[model samples]
Target: MNRSKPKAPAPDEPLPVEIVDAHTHLDACGAKDAADVTAMLDRAAAVGVGRVVTVANDLTAARWAAEAATWDERVFAAVAVHPTRTAVFSEQDRAVVAELAGRDRVVAVGETGLDFYWDYSPPAAQEEAFRWHIDLAKRVGKPLMIHDRDAHEDIWRVLEAEGPPETVVFHCFSGDLEFARRCVDRGYVLSLAGTVTFRNARALREAAVHIPTYQLLVETDAPFLTPHPFRGRPGEPYCAAYTLRDLAQLRGADVAELGAAVAANAQRVFRLPAVTARELRGREG
Candidate 1:
């Protein structure tokens, strides 16, 4: 495996409409403070990505993500202990995450769900945390952002048993057509990342076609899953523009229409403030 840092892909042409990176990590994308946040959002805004929901997978990152959201109007935060990190998740940690999740700009309680792919945390511990986060999302009245990986059935089982909050987002959705139908049927928003752009992602592309516009979302999942032709390259929020275009093409929808739909979906799913297309194109930020 190449241990070298992946270089960023060259910027793609700006999309004709607007988009929001429904899931990303500003910290991992090189944002450290307000200035860095401004600069990063600018880079994203330059290419039609007007907003992003920076997610946290741990206590410290949850704090950073919450604070980062306050730094920029275009940035939002999603706070939760990722399922993989649930082994050591404690009461104090839960307190802080709960406080952060209730903040005005902390739009979701998430990046939390089952991840059986890694044994960093036992299944029992993960389920316990997942249930707590689900309850927190309901209490805080925020959307639930899920990080389902190799645990789709279990994720669904937990969600059904817990009686999911009003809204749920399957971040970086990695399910097949059948699963996609199930999620959409239950009114869950599926946030697709750049994984759909891979050459071997034919199944994903086919699944994308069946999803309704209202239930669709797009993201970069940046610093990872950089779209094809730049597969190994580092991605930033701006890359959501590339992913949006490709998704639109794959779904056989007009780029502008799909962009508008997904942008609307993001705004609603995350309960984000309005981001007018004019402001984004004019670079008003």
Candidate 2:
């Protein structure tokens, strides 16, 4: 059970409790082959992650995930043009994204929002692309996963304009406590990732403490933000355990209780099937 070993999980494995990684980039997780994905999923299943919402940054990634989802029951896809890639969302890109949204495996439209931190695309372009994603999510009757980085105010402005999405989630939410309050007032779900388990991520910790439990979610954003204790290593979906523990500590709740709640939250937002502990155990075996 070494972290780096690649192996197949038993077809009907069982886990102690099921976990749902509300966000991740499986394409970026070095899972370029079936063996790689099996290893990833096995490691995750070993640690209780039963499902994950894998986000794609562009049309190519969307197509990749769309195909992957058909092969892995535990993997679900989210299609969108990332903010940094806004300038690349050509007409063809929009058509493909639209088409992908119609797929059964595609659950959300996202990782679309303002990222002033990188500014890879012009502000106007990012905004326009973000609005388009919101519109697509609305049309498709799916949730919207936003990625706001140093552009909180602008995100708020656009959110106010578009109004609440069918289900609105702030992926890898790093906003301040006041912004957290604003998001809560708007009934937005805040998804905390591995960053919340970092010692210096007091803002994320604060958000975990203050945000309503029902409005909070956990994700790995895998291949990134591996969280404390496992920092400095390639992240994976199983690391949701660390995030779950951290949030439980922040909210003064039991680990198992928090795990169950986050798993349910992920299912609700993504419209994923709810697996009983029995089914989760069978998958882990």
Candidate 3:
């Protein structure tokens, strides 16, 4: 049976707003070409997701994401091969990531980190790749976007061994409260995604409270992990709004404050420019 296509956004004049999505993947989102990206951005902007860090797990996707970032002011790119894609890394891979790090439109060095959930790569290979990506982040003076999954101990060990990153953001954080405290102590940023809205995400919710407000971030990880209300559906960057709203309620802060905090956290972590639609369009020009 054919699945229904994702509903495209209605054409509406873009509005001015201040928002940011800490994580996204443009190449894998099924939006091909400039017009597709324009529509996706329109949909995100309509819901106040004004800025997004489009992450790519390989050189091809990284290049595409960087080009996409150039297409719109709000879109910034994160370049790194994911844990599962460790085999793709080579000496030239490091050089390319270093080069991408220098681009103005490129933000962080990630969606990198440990993911033992599916050990497609040998554990040693994953560790090596994670270290390499972390080194890239250090070399470029950018934050490291981590993707830890069921390998918390190993992740901590590697980070400690490699020396702590200046800016460490746990994208799609899934650690327990103790781990949250450890991350907080290290001044690492904990980014919550759609999964936090799940009824069974007790550990995530508990960890959320323990993290300092300024240290918290929200993401979509979209094209995956759609939150509770939309769970079982394909996720998208625009759905980050729902996650943000749920987080604010959990934290007992106003949604406006939540937005401001997460947006600030994103800017701090990604070093993204203060992107308004007008500013973004100017960049596109």
Candidate 4:
């Protein structure tokens, strides 16, 4: 959908420490093959964005995400029928996603949850799919990454009712300080994205300050919410550096210290390898 030309933004000075992109969409970002995946990661690694978890929006994308993870050690995958696509989710679709969720490189089950902004799927359908994905994440013993867009209350309702997965992540967290406090109290991780850099997102910025260092994560949601200044342009994983810098400044924490904390949070939530094996594989290639 993002047909903008795939050009890397001017690179930021690399961070003193590396961090992982807790969520992204490589396929949607124009990464079509192993070469594309490598090239994307190369750009990201240059700015200390060392690892990524590319997530799926539908059954077809789920399969692609699984395969892409195998193409590079730095890349991991999350599979699910996005809330918007719940209108078409069938028994066969669930079977496919379940299989993908159990794959070794598939670290999370998500980009699920509710989205009231989009009417492509009815509320009942979205709720049904969200519950199913929660169960799948529990079964697979993986974190559940949520995509909440103007549907926070219902999202919270279902998550609370069905009971959340052990490791719950509010991807691109769009809640206010009060709501953030509840999520933190419930032990859910809040993943900040480019939107937090927007001048108008004052509430989100304030909420970021309240989140404990270990409960925070960063992401690009690439090809979507590019950070400020480059707001209208296409975003790549490498752009995460800008957001990391902004977040560090907002929290009044050193960039390196914040980066290290987020990296640890991502590694813990996704159960990523201690080191990025793909960087070595990339050099070998």
Candidate 5:
């Protein structure tokens, strides 16, 4: 399939505080090599998107994400066979994902979970893979990043049945306030993406307002779900600034304060190492 290329708009005003892009696909965003990744990160950093977690949906992409994390101190990785690809998931695929999940820079064990919208994979296959990934996340002692789409109940059921990992994050959370409350009550983190910026996403925006600051995170899910005003265009980690700003407005909170809280939540959830001032400056230099 020919995918639309990302649209690069002029960078937004710099955020008063730095934040992390909890989930993105650097490879799918057309970042081919170290130089390309660096260039993207450079643009992100200029707007205070200081760190990013590039995720993978398959074995080859998983390998690339792991290597990309090592390329920059600011980049981390999450690896798994996406739910849609679970139909073809095999023992070898499982082994590779398990291996990658244990890597130093592979901070999360997902982009996994249920996706019932597409018929590409059977529900059984998706469930089985979701269970396996849940186990993998527990075994590797990393947070489980979920990709729930039109399968919220099944997603919750499987997670409850499998006994989710200590840290469970609903990537690009698509539920309303009630679902958000359920997740929050269960101690799950909700990572909001650009979709929250859409005018028609009233429910999503409302959910965002109710989520406690400590349980909130921000992501771009780049190359897709670009924020409004730039919707239908490409998105990147830097574009997270737009989402963060919008979210802060919805919550009636200060942008810098919210950014700091979200950054802390990401660090705690992903167990990211604290970057020294010297190292941070070196990257900026």
Candidate 6:
């Protein structure tokens, strides 16, 4: 099935208020060094996406993400072996992820959890790895970022069983209203991505409308899940501006107001420093 490379969306106006991309993948977006990493974040910062938490889905990405975060003050890292890649997950792998997860720039232990949508890893292996990441997050006192896909019930079940970390962020949250409510009620932060902008994502929009400001966040999940009108395009951290506008419209909230809240929530959950956003804005001007 050969297909053309998706077009990139043209940049939108920078938001009036700054925001953080709660999760994204600088490495997967084709960044390979300090210069590449800086270029990406520069594009994002130019559009008011002042900071981003680049997440890892495997050991290779985990190492890249940790180092990439240090390339720029605005980039942070989340390291984990994704559930789909957990088939070969071992004590050795856990040790490596743990070491990376402990880095000061690594703010969360994740993109971990079950993804029944793909058979890359058996359910048992996924569960084991998820539990290990959960414990690591707790031990290191960092938030746990999840990648739930068609395994919502068991996702909650596992989190419950392990007594979740102090903060849990559902990265690229795909749940409908009911599940969103459950997550919100449990005090989990929902990091909505470009999916919320899709015309077909009715239920996700419904969930977005009800999420309290304090418990809500936004992300690009890019180089994938680009927002509507540009749904088929490759997304970037800068695309957070588009999603934020659409999300604000859906929730009937002012764009700047919602952006502020989303930014605040990302900082609180990821424990990212707030000073940089202001400094970034000053430089962008």
Candidate 5 residue lDDT tens string, 215-248: 9999999978989789988788899999999889
C-alpha root-mean-square deviation, each candidate: 2.0, 4.5, 3.0, 2.5, 2.3, 1.7
- Please, what are the lDDT tens digits per residue for candidate 6 over residues 111-227? 999999998999999999999999999999999999999999999999999999999999989999999999989999999999999999899888889988899999989988999
> Distance from true position, residue 110, model 1, in Å?
0.7
lDDT (Cα) of model 5? 0.92
Question: Which regions in candidate 5 have their CA more than 4 angstroms from the true location?
Answer: 1-6, 276-279, 283-285
- Candidate 2 lDDT by residue in tens digits, 212-237: 88888899898788877676667778
Task: Tell me which of candidates 1 and 2 scores higher on lDDT.
Answer: 1
lDDT for each residue of candidate 3 in 1-285, tens digit (9 for 90 to 100): 998865532322322335687898866777777888878887887777888889988788887887888886668889888898885578988787778877888888888887888858778888899998888888888889999999999999999999966999999999989999999899999988889989899988888877898898888888888887777677667888888878878878788877877788788778766556546666668
Clash pairs detected, candidate 4: none
lDDT of each: 0.89, 0.83, 0.81, 0.92, 0.92, 0.91
Candidate 3 lDDT for residue 188: 93
- Residue pairs in collision within model 6: none
**Which candidate, 2 or 4, would have the higher TM-score against the true structure?**
4
What local lDDT does model 2 show for residue 127?
93
Clashing pairs in 1: none
lDDT of 2 at 124: 92
